[model samples]
Target: MAKRKWLRGLALLLLVALLVVGGMYLYGSSSGTVPPATVDFAKLSPEQEKTLYARGEQVFRAGDCAACHSSPQTGAELAGGVPMVTPMGTLYGTNISPSKQHGIGNWTADDLYRAIASGVAPSRKLLYPAMPYTSYHQVTRGDVDALWVWLMKQPAVEVANRANAMQFPFDVRPAVALWNAVERPAAKPFDASTDALSRGKYLVDVMGHCAECHSPRTLTFALDKSRYLEGSIIEGAYAPAITPAALSGRGWTRDDLVRFFRTGLSPQGVMTFRMASVLDHSTSHMPEEDLRAMAAYLTQDQAMPGPKPKAPQGEVNVKGEAIYVGLCAGCHGVQGQGQPQSSVPLNTNTTAMFPTPINLIRVTREGLQERDLPHGGRMQSMPGFADKLSDQDMADLVNYLRQTWGGQPGDVTPAQVADLVKTIEHGDQ
Candidate 1:
């Protein structure tokens, strides 16, 4: 009698657990409130179509869609082969071109809206958070309608999406519903109400999605809202803090911010790492007024303390100074004043000023390629020193830069550099 009662209790417990799991899956698999589509596609006149096409192009540029979706080999804007690395695994951007076989050509505007705003694609496919739907949760439906018209009009590419390389547990696509139930925000439209500041917030937070990289992530890989835009290490590089105070402390002005977006160069520094793609695809193409508004939002339209040389933080290392003179002083002067359009000035450069030395180390070891920037800006090639420098040598050189120009302590060690090297190499893989 006792054994039969125990088995019955065990079965009941299993049934209860199954019921809870099933209920959670049902709730998570469903999308939150998606706003109604603003335009009637069938009834639009020629003039309306023209207006939507222009607005959609603007929306696409603002979203920086090409940076991820464009083909690195062919430079096809929506062919979608770029790889995004994360802690869980690598996810390739999907083909968004207008091909019915491989792209979204058959998707109605409402389908596009559901995908963008609620993170639910057709057939209830849940997109990985790498798509930035969290930040885009508040995007306006009107902008999406315009984007749909423009996207559908573009030439279709027949490229199929590359399979994701997610490790076990994450490889199960349906399991994403659990993450969604816990972390995803409800979709809502942003109110941009004709105010510059409001519009700037809309552009930066909703469309630009800057916080997706700049903000630190929780253990679950969701963005930590408490420290929004305070800086974080991602893909082996540090995305620096862009809070108004942080920007002002690093000698950024509103005009300089506009200049950086417009040209990818300012006294602050040149765009590097993932931001290089951003410059090529998005900011450089943005309008002057929009750029101004972004800058205004970043700086809160406040008067800022301009670039000034930082005082040396500690005793300079003799070996580090020698390395700088021997290798670096040719382009960057002995005093760190860079040549015109060739290299950025180091004294006022913000890389070393960051809380972590990861970017400085990464850039030094990897180097930057020569490139023609948009809007009359250009930078010569900077050579990588990976083969030439030992771990100790890199630590010393980075320490020297931090002390002399960054107003930071010379505290990096060879062991720390070796660990960072592993991280950099892994990210490259």
Candidate 2:
């Protein structure tokens, strides 16, 4: 009787495995649909073409193309060697530069548009969702065409394409099809009725793809649109909530936001995280009118209820306070006050006040450096203490900063530090 029961259980397991494989096979074999581009280049005059090309450049910047496509040190503009970390695996950016040998030089305008709108490559492979095609799909056809033109015009480098290091089933392109069929929303026609609102919606949802970093994902890795930009952690940085409810007591005005979008600075602090990258590559280049439209749309009808400062300063370890005075005080200022001349401000900074602890932990361990901010000019840098400070010391130090400087109460643990270390080093699976 025992022998018979074992045989039945083994048979059941095999049957289940076969069913899953068969379902995947069916999903993978099917080809996804691609829509046609909206703008008709054939009918346009030479002057119109020039205008479209310029418009396309703005759109590309708005999409923050350089953040991923251009490598940090060695890669050419849009040559694509940056590696993007996703839950499934690591994905390397491709050479979209127009090099006929290794880049998209051979790709026609239609192919480019199809890739952007449908995430379907000309080679018939299904591109990953990490490229934000779901959001790009909603972009206007004219803008998409303009983007294509601009991309094709860039100097093509002979950089080789890098394969994604995704796990078993995810490594397969067809698997993305099944994920898309369920997760990807149908592209809606541009609604021009709301004027600035429609433009804002398109810019935020498509061009900006703000939700890509700010919002959390579902079990299958789809953006949880219900929560919208309520904020989530991305690659170890705290992307704090930007909604009205979240911004209520923060005291950041629309003017502050508009200025930040252009200059990457605010009264609270400088754009220190991935946001700094966005401002450098994208928002700062946008037209003033478009930027205002985006601001109006983002803030909507929400009223700013002035400042609501927290309670009295909390206690921090003496050692942590000493570390702050010795290393951090000169720049960040004592008791979290930023140096008057520097862009760095601490008393009302978002990094310390945010409920999430990743940014603080990261800045403490890795430190922040001023990189290329072509539009915003060069900002200051912070030297890292990864080697100098232990996990406990760093935690105590951060806790001290939050309490004394930020008027926020929080505690940090060594174990949390360990997890953050892992996250910063290995990235998510």
Candidate 3:
């Protein structure tokens, strides 16, 4: 009886797998109704071409592509050697350089556009969503063409591609096609509106893709609309909620936003982790008018009212202090000041001031990977400790750090700790 039951269960699982695979095969094979050759760059005028080139440069910075594609030690922009971690496994960014043998030297403008907009390669394999087509889809076609031109103009190097570290079921590319068919939204133009707020909304949603971090996602990696802009885990960092309610803890003002975007620092503290990388490579290079608009938009948005509850000054208990001493003191020092050579100062980290503890916990769990900085700078890498500490330990350690070093007494419940762990493990809040 037991053998019969096991066989039946196994059969059911196989059947479901077959159905999913078959659906993906059909979807990917048939749904690509358009040809790559349809990309018509001929329609662009000389002036339009120049504008597209400029916008493409902006998009490259905005997306922080160089940070991934470039090697930090060699200072090779877009030459590619960064390894990205995912639940499926680790995948390395490929050389987008125009090296004839190893990179996209032979790829046409259409190939580039399809790769960006549809996550489809020239050979029709679906790229992993880790490539962030969800955000790239908002990029205009003209901009993509210009980017292609710019990329081609760069010095090409023949750096070999690294093998992917994905698990068995996920190592396969066809599965992503299935995932896309079920979960991916088709690229569409930003909805036009008369008001500045409405326009800002479109930019943030489609072009900026702010929600990619600020919002949570389901187990299948679909955005959870219920808690839009409520913050989530991405790439080992907790992207905090940028909603009106969450910004109160940061004490952000209109001017602060503009300054932070322009210089990667605010009155609260300096940007670190992914946010700092974004500013140094992307936002700071954007037009001043756009920066002002983004700032104005954030200021107008409402935040949750009232003072956020934090650990009172010097109220960290002995237990919390012990956790920091035992685990953190070696790297962070006795006073929570990080090693200036390799670590960020915990006392003044912008991440320590977030309303929630996800960012703090996430960074502690997963050490950072070094990436490129604009103007020939490089950020230091840190190790992640997701598997090392328990929820109580994390809460205690973080509470101690925030109070002792971060000025604010940010209290984190065990429940919050558990929730953040779950979010990081699942790759979303």
lDDT of each: 0.89, 0.74, 0.67
* Among all candidates shown, the one with the greatest lDDT: 1
User: Against the hidden true structure, what lDDT does model 1 obtain?
Assistant: 0.89
- What TM-score quantifies how close candidate 2 is to the native fold? 0.88
After superposing candidate 3 on the true structure, give the runs of residues whose Cα lies further than 4 Å from its correct spot: 1-24, 28-51, 191-203, 299-350, 353-397, 401-429
Sort by lDDT, top down from the best: 1, 2, 3
lDDT of 3 by residue, 56-78 (tens): 77767655676567765575777
**Residue 123 in candidate 3 has what lDDT?**
68
* Candidate achieving the largest TM-score: 1
Worst 10 residues of 1 by lDDT: 20-29
lDDT of 1 by residue, 33-72 (tens): 7677788889999999999999999999999999989998
TM-score of 1: 0.94
lDDT of 2 by residue, 154-182 (tens): 77788787777987556756556667677
Evaluated at residue 241, the lDDT of candidate 2 is 83
